[model samples]
Target: MKLWDYDAFILDLDGTLIDSGKYHAQAFADAVLAQSGYRLKPYEHHEFFGKHSIWFAEDLNERYGLSLDPQEVLKHKRERVQEIFVAELFAGAQAFLEFWCGKKTMALATNSPLEFVEPALRDAQIFNCFDVITTASDVKRRKPDPEIIEITAERLDVEPEHTLVFEDQLIGIKAARAAGAKVIAVDNGQPVNYPVDVAVHTWNDLLKLSELHRWNPN
Candidate 1:
């Protein structure tokens, strides 16, 4: 199928449309350090992508053998994220979204909580682009569980098999696949090694590819 052949488009927030992964990682690192006095190893933050803060905190506890409260770490990380995070959309992300605004059924699905997701979308000025928005708070389980993606597809009133998910992390891709959606790995410098139906380095590449498919939004 062509890039624009899908009935709906589901996009992951961090690392996919926005470049906030570093901020998220830093916030998590700070939270872990403040709570457990253990610094996260370099690139350890990448492992936490596409997961809820509580899940990440629990994982930290298990990995480091620390008796840290997941709730406390989650709270601290949220506060740090609010103070430090600055939404910066990936190149051509706004354009791609704008181009498909009224042309396709779209949803923003992320493991990030609504507290973080809302402001980021608003800051990026693409909050209104999606027909539906699904966040961690909206589901009992996050990415890699398929609940988030499933719910997003349902909310968009589209079948998972007819939806196309754009993700950066393997967990999100796994969830999308599990939900029965085709996956497009959006590489933001760090390339995804997982198998996907399509892979593009940036939103610009996707835009060009879509144009080549001759699928007009009109």
Candidate 2:
């Protein structure tokens, strides 16, 4: 559990590092309702949680008998979500990060596209904190696929086994675990069904672990 034992660190956005899932759900629901007069229910929001917006849009189109292009719908949804993000970070995320500055190499690996990531983190004033930042737009496959995690490890020159991931979504946890990293699952957003190495309900949980694990060297 030691920070120094890990070669690289990975984190998920939306839910893990930020409390923006509700905004995302609202945006998606609004977009679909406006475009096709279809309402995405709460269960549907849960189902779409960790996926790429394009896939979510396509799924909605197929489910509702609509002919909207996935890309166009996704673009609209993103614009709406951005309006809701508005220079915010998860409660306690920035202060927690301050304690670990320069202690480990960090990366942000999310299924969100670069368009959203760039603005969100920058607006939150944490764009420079990570050593690497990647999104679904940069990868051939998204979460539940190990390609992004593998690429992240490779780029950071970090062994997959020594990497630690802070993920919010079950699919993201699966993807990071599949890449051979140990994971800490954050529960600030919607709940999930994945088994995690550790479950953290708040930044305090992470901070507590950091103090206990810092000098242990794994």
Candidate 3:
């Protein structure tokens, strides 16, 4: 399907629109180390990038046999994120969102909590572009569970089948698929083996496509 064919667009926050992956990873790493004395390897941080902090904590508990409380870990991670996280949007992300803000229904669906998401959106100056914003605090489950995406679509009054999700991680892709939305894998140089309707290296590519479609009705 063409990019404009979807009734709504749902975007993931961290890696998809903003370049906040490393900062989030640092917060998680710091939390895990302080709580359980187990420092996460750099590569291991990527494995939990798009999910909730509780998932990361629980997985670490199971994998390393640590009895750390998920809530406590999450709290520490949030604290660290608040202290060190700086919001930075990927190139062309703001322009792309601006281009389609009014022409199409848009929503921000992310596994990150409101505290993390709000500042990032405001910093990027695209907070008003979304018709709805669904974060981790809004759902019982995060990405890979479909609850977040499902809630976002419901809030937008759009059908999952008619929505297109732009994601940078496997868990987000899985969630979008489970929610019955078409997927556009944001290629951030990470290898994605899963199937998607399309893949682009940056939002600049989509911006160009939107311009093309706008200028050419046929």
The better-scoring model by TM-score among 1 and 3 is 3
Q: After superposition, how far is residue 73 of candidate 2 from its true place, in Å?
A: 1.8
Q: Give per-model CA RMSD.
A: 2.3, 2.4, 1.8
* Cα-based lDDT at residue 38, candidate 3: 93
Per-residue accuracy of model 1 over 10-56 as CA lDDT, tens digit each: 99998899999888889988998998899988767776665667777
Q: If both were scored by lDDT, which would come out higher, candidate 2 or candidate 3?
A: 3
Say which candidate scores most in TM-score.
3
TM-score of 1: 0.90
Model 3 CA deviation exceeding 4 Å by range: 196-201
Query: Which pairs of residues have clashing backbones in candidate 1?
Result: none
lDDT of 2 by residue, 1-218 (tens): 45556777888887888777777878877777778778888888877777766788887778778876777677778889877755557777787677677887889898888988888888788888899998888899888898889888888888888898888887888898899888877767566765734555577777766766666545
What TM-score would you give candidate 3 relative to the actual structure? 0.91
lDDT of each: 0.85, 0.78, 0.86
TM-score of each: 0.90, 0.87, 0.91
Best-fitting candidate, scored by lDDT: 3
Residue 174 of candidate 2: its Cα lDDT?
86
The collision pairs in model 2 are: none
